[model samples]
Target: MGRRLLLGMLFLLSVKIMAQEKDSRLCLGLNYGFGSEFNNTDYTFINHFYKLQLYYKLSETKHFQYEILIQPEINFAKHQLLNFYFVKPETPDYQQKREDYTQLKEVREYVLNLGFLVRKPIGKSCSVYVLGSIGPMINDTETERMSKGFAFADVLALGFSFKMKKIHFDIRPEIRHVSNAGLSGKNGGYNTRNIEFGVSYSL
Candidate 1:
């Protein structure tokens, strides 16, 4: 993974250097974020993600542009712990078995997303953008010996970007919503919301 990241960065840097003199050229970048899951009682869990984005100018005078963003992520969550903490002994039979005496388990997930954005440049080096995307992802639950796949989940984001000469940098704060369609009804719609921050540099 580290090697892959290093190689990707080097490639993006090369592209930026080559396009420094072009009036209207495409830019590529990388983004990364460190944060925690929301509504998650398990404070011990952490979430991190990485993204790659490409931008192309449509009309230089109008600040019109198009963008593509690719994000791959891993999530470690403990939502089951929250349920266990709230269960009472007086609960019904099924409830007791499912909550009170149930053990807390941790789940891990892997996801890949592809997105598109509409951007309007604000100045010589800045722009504001809105994005929407849908893609397939794989979900793996280690504790339950379960693995599932999903397709066509949606995400929406709003952020900004900065460009200087031949070098382009972007910083976008975004919200991501995902729905996992259960595999054979064994695992169903488990939704997650995340706030992501990313940075990218392109020549």
Candidate 2:
């Protein structure tokens, strides 16, 4: 009976040590990004964005890992002008009237998102992952004819990660979409494609 008790204690200790060796509990990351709008024809320059993320490892196996993450992001862009030119005829006469007006300027946007990440390990320290996120977004430029103050945002990303001791680095290419941009009467939404690089510290 004493021999069996000693063996059981030794087994529990080994299991505890194994759990500690495979720990990837929590992570914090920051990323920088550069991107451009996909459907905008008038924009001349690519935009700059930044993100801060917090991740919690929900579950893991020898080959796969799953995480839940929250990210807050912001984007900065150049101001743009929308011009409308109209030509009208007065009293059905030969004379014509022409008028032009400027509409709205594109500015900055802020987003807060919650997402899930699925990672598959390829080697000891290298992995590939995919992520999807959805949340709320706000833009600086909100007008009757343009995007609203609140909108729904969605993100999709594919990336690779390299783990080093307690630190991990990631490079991801992502696509983001905003629905009902500016609550504008025209209902023209927004879409962007970007690449992001991030460094994270694991706990």
Candidate 3:
């Protein structure tokens, strides 16, 4: 009787493993979003972004599972503002323009990024995640650029992942904050936010 019981247990375990394997999924995807930056001194700028990625899942179904994401992105920036100081006595009409001492200008930037993500499932078809990355931006202006160096930033991303049989997709509304982050016309160290959409195919 003991031998029979052991055999039954092994059979059950085998069935469970097969079920999991049949339901497992792996995916590759593309992402697109809009982005912007805000300087430490309150100057503001805007940009749009795009990316391509590879996504992977290690389990079939779980309240929590491990995730891996590799993505490359491109960001385009514009509408930059530059500020300075003008003392009341230094201007032709110092007192008249004293209240408007700062100036605003338009500029543009291009940023390239590479990122890694780890995610946890919060719902049947959704997950929340966080990411960290370092990259560079080639800009069209000076003071607003990456100090002629590489740009660095950290981003927080939250979104839902969806699966249909063996196929899956992900979408995240993300907020990114950078220190010493710039392209060509805008300076580094600012807050940026964007909404991203990604679609994937599992192997």
Candidate 4:
């Protein structure tokens, strides 16, 4: 009876170790981003993002891993516009339009990104990944380039992740497009190139 109880305890310990190994697949990440180089004329956009990321494993391969990324974030932007081409020459409010488009504006956006990532391990502690994401955004201010209210942000990124113990550090460079998809008449949007840094902890 003593020997049987000892065996049962060892089996339970082994099961707990396996559960720990499997539970480490989930992670939480905090990311920050910076962007510049607007695509439209007379427009300067300074962009920043604070992201809370929840990572879920989608599937796995022998040499690659696939993950689902969901991010809820806040975007703060500073905008400067010095040109006015949206209004025509004969329009009644042409001068007023020009005046409105020539000032400094602060815009805030609420964003949610649903993403898919595929990664390949380079060695024991390093990996490379490609991520594609698109989601909705709520624009809190209006501009000559685009309307306020509803839009979408699409992103594509390539990055590397370095794991140190239970924490991961990531460096990513990405391109982004923010547009209304013809949902509004004033749908000329903003385009930017960005770089992001992140730190994550495994569950």
Candidate 5:
């Protein structure tokens, strides 16, 4: 009787594993972000981006699922400094620095981010998720807050997704920070809040 009970337990475990099988998918979307007071800085920023994503099942349980994401993004941003911190009166170029840092400027960025997502199902076709990612970025314009070259972008988001047939619609609210990780002397970064809408298909 003990042997029979052990065999039954093994069979149930296998069935549970099989029930959680998942497939890969692709997603595309746009994101618009703006600076918020959470950064402890006076500068304000705005950005819009085109996003491409590919994701697959990494793990699962009866109550949760995990996914790995490869996402590439291209964005344009507008920035303006609202404080005198970047311009010190003691500096030789104080006048020039003040003139440069206070003006509105447009910048472009290229990014490739690797993300990990944790999801919980609400029903048959809807779920809530949390996602985090960090990746390399290339900035095309120099600013008082950051340098003009290589940087890192980090993101954390909370999202909801609804699936209809093979199509999935998502809404995500996120916080993002970009810095060069001290690769250069000017490492002050920009922090922003972003809302993203996206659609994905399962293949």
Candidate 6:
């Protein structure tokens, strides 16, 4: 009877240790990316994107060895223009009105997102993941020609994570879409594809 009791206690202790090793609570990350041009724009523009993220681990399943997380992120993009524009009114002598012209300049965009991440371990310390998010996005340029404030945003990403002692390194390719649906009629939607690299700390 004493031998049986000793074995039961040892089993419980080992389970506890395994649980502790698998526990992950929080993580912080930063990433940088280069994206394609904004769609539906009158002027030619290029983009460079950067991001910062925070993640909270919600649950883990040992049977499948997968974890679910909630992630909140902020993204910034710098838009460089290849041309300049200006609006000109119709001339008195001509019946037709003049169209707006294009100019070269830099514009910045900001976005805030909340999303879910599903991470599955591939090896002892490496994992592959996918995520989806929705948020609001705005741009420094308030003109109708550019994306206005309060645009609806959505994102999808696929990435791999390499875990160290207390840190995680990640590389992801992502796509972002901003829609003006039900928001504005003047501006259409835009989409971008980018590859990003990030480092995160586990807490």
Model 2: per-residue Cα lDDT over 7-73, one tens digit each: 9999999988877754567789899988877754443335778889898989898888999999998
Q: Clashes in candidate 1: how many?
A: 2
Tens digits of per-residue lDDT for model 4, 1-203: 99999999999999999878666668899999999854656689889999998888778889999999999989999877756776567757778877876778899989999999999999889999999999999998888778899999999999999999889999999999899998976787888899999999887
The sequence of per-residue lDDT tens digits that candidate 6 reaches over residues 3-119 is 999999999999988766554666777777777754643445456666677777776786233334434344554443322332223434221212222334455666777777887
Model 3: per-residue Cα lDDT at residue 185: 29
Which 10-residue window in model 5 sums to the lowest lDDT?
A: 22-31
TM-score of each model, in listed order:
0.61, 0.73, 0.60, 0.89, 0.82, 0.68
lDDT of all predictions:
0.56, 0.74, 0.59, 0.88, 0.82, 0.64
Q: What's model 5's TM-score?
A: 0.82
Worst-scoring 10-residue span by lDDT in model 6: 93-102
TM-score of 4: 0.89
Better of 2 and 3 by TM-score: 2
* Residues 71-137 of candidate 3: C-alpha lDDT, one tens digit per residue: 6666665544344341326546755443442344343444555565666766656666665555555
Which ranking of candidates, highest lDDT first?
4, 5, 2, 6, 3, 1
> In candidate 4, where is summed lDDT lowest over 10 consecutive residues?
82-91
How does model 5 fare in lDDT?
Answer: 0.82
Per-residue lDDT of candidate 5, residues 1-203 (tens digit)? 99999999999998776654433333444443444425545787888886787777777799998988888988788888888666668867888887888999898989998999999989999999999999999999888888899999999999999988768888888998899999985788988888888887775
Model 5 bad stretches (over 4 Å): 1-41, 90-92
Clashing pairs in 4: none
Residue 173's lDDT in candidate 5: 89
Top candidate on lDDT is: 4
Error of 6 at 132 (Å): 0.5
